[model samples]
Target: MNILTAMSSRLTVPFLDLKSQYRQHQAAFDGAMGAVIAEAAFAGGPWVERFEAEFAAYCGTTYAVGVANGTVALWMVLLAMGIGPGDEVITVPSSFIATAEAISFCGAKPVFVDIQEADCNMDPGLLKAAISSRTKAIIPVHLFGHPANMEAILAIAQEHGLPVVEDAAQAHGARYDGKMAGSMGLAGCFSFHPVKNLGAFGEAGAVITNDGELAQKLQRLRDHGQFEKYQHEVIGWNGRMDGLQAAVLSTKLPFLEERNAQRRQRAGWYFEQLGGIPDLVLPASLPEVEHAWHQFPVRIPCRDAVFAAMQGAGIGCSIHYPVPIHRQKAYHFLGLPEGSFPVAERCSREFLSLPIFPELTEEQVRTVTRVLKLWITRNHRVKNIAFSGKLAV
Candidate 1:
């Protein structure tokens, strides 16, 4: 019997255990939901307003507008900023498609840029060349809870007279140079999907901004552009966040900091255990930034084989993205070829997201590392033996 087969019977770890998180604060969640039910505020009402205020304060922003989901959060921000046909938005291709989709949906072109090899975030050096005469805005995504190089990105934006909207979907409490991820830009967008750090029971999202006029415009844009009942001021969509999701998010917000700390702790354990592996490349963090550790993705040789081996050992592993957005069929019109963004394309092929969550225990982490190490060791030995055989022949 192999190491993987033997370990499979003794241990099993999931990528995320939301049920355990729910059980940790069941009463608070239930009571909050019950209150919303009692008031019958099923749509946008007091609960949604309460969460918006609390979230804004937490992000150190003057205002936050609740919306249906993170995609729409980005979409709404672009719309409110007057981004439309003939405009262009600059962002990296090493992110979820939603980042670029939001721009495409707004009738603007998404100009792709490569990311830094070390941190897998946007490379500020490349940002300047991508800006064109039609460039209207910049959307810097805080990918995998690691804040991007905002100081440099912002300086360039200011020089070009452009607005920046932070994509903080996976970086709820991440900080950069003592500033919150979403607070540094003109407006920051967030998502409250069940898997996020501060998630609701279902889809929810918000935009935080220091500009009050922008806040009011977002509020109107989310609700049919209504200035008053039966009074439509501008064309809009049904993007309002439901009251139930808002209540659930509010209940989960207070505990987000604690959970983020736990995630960091888990990340440290991964570094301590896997750092010495010669062929493994661990995730990198920038100086003066606090990473939220949303996903601990590491690059390794023979990633597909190792991933399958880990699965056989009862460990839940995933790939954040196996394909870059530029290569996707949906974006074929962009005319970007295979090597447009080499770093992102390489990462998409080799990156593996191991099991990581607040509820994951130290022992579980140990099991995961052990399985990975065993696979690497065995694969190396087999390759060496084959090389020797070839020499003898």
Candidate 2:
């Protein structure tokens, strides 16, 4: 109950600490919750509607359709595109399982693509070769908050007359070439999971698109395939965003850009402190892109050992993904043989997500860098080391 007790209990650094965020916005959060409860508008209500409008404007899209979760957002976009059964969707193997889960649940197969070793995003140069006669859609993920090469991807899609779906689940406010993440694709799917840049208090998602017809159909798909209540025109699942989650999102939406700016500043600290280290490869800060930094992922030799040291020192750390999607037990049915996605597979072994939330203080950032330097000095192999696409030896 004392300040000392509170200070002592908090972790020196945490991967994410929503507790601080909630405390900072307690009044607005409480007000939002009270309004939702007072209205008894539990699902698909006014709050959700308001959030969709606000989010659409923020993302620079014509429409934003709220859904139950990020996975549902992706599925609705695909269903709205009329892509399923006998269709294959192209995406990277470096992403979370939800990307592929949405595809499989829609009765479509996921064709894997390698990522850019620098930004960990889908490599647009390799996209053309992955296309097939049955490739109904292309889902390019903005992995770890960096925007994908939207201009190149869009050109390729136009050439092939294929629709592009951006898995912007981790890149809420990221921008590429001055445009927002979700605005470049046919539909940009977002997750408002608690850890995302624009997180809701709980699970929530939205789909943003410029096409009026596709946006309209996506809205219908998320609400049991109805233009209105109890009037189903097509088969759809229960994917409506709840009023409570929407209320929370609306309360937080105003502060998202400010929070994102802080995350950027924190990431700069990482780059400044860790850059040019021969044994450690920092995440890429590519040109013409603004990263939202949902996860500050780095690649280093002896990644697991470094992760253990960080966590052991109460500096929370995790692997972005230790296993690629193609190598997972669930995807064995796809029969994507080993070495199918070399870049993503290599990243799986090396990518370590460092704690880089807006709530993290500058001193905490310094502390993290200090510990990392100590560990890397002791364990990393510096012989003929290359970093950030250049030789460091």
TM-score of each: 0.96, 0.93
Best by lDDT: 1
Candidate achieving the largest TM-score: 1
lDDT of 2 by residue, 206-236 (tens): 9999899998888788777888779999987
lDDT by candidate, in order shown = 0.91, 0.87
Across residues 1-393, which tens digit of lDDT does each residue of candidate 1 receive? 666767789879998898987798899889999999999998899999999999999999999999999999999999999999999999989899999999999999999889998689999999999999999999999999999999999999999999999999999999999899999999999999998888889999999999999998999999999969879999988899999999999888898999999999999999999987878999997787999999999998667777877887799999878899899999999999999999999999889999889999999999899888877777776754532111111
List all candidate RMSDs to the true structure. Answer: 3.0, 5.5
lDDT of 2 at 238: 85
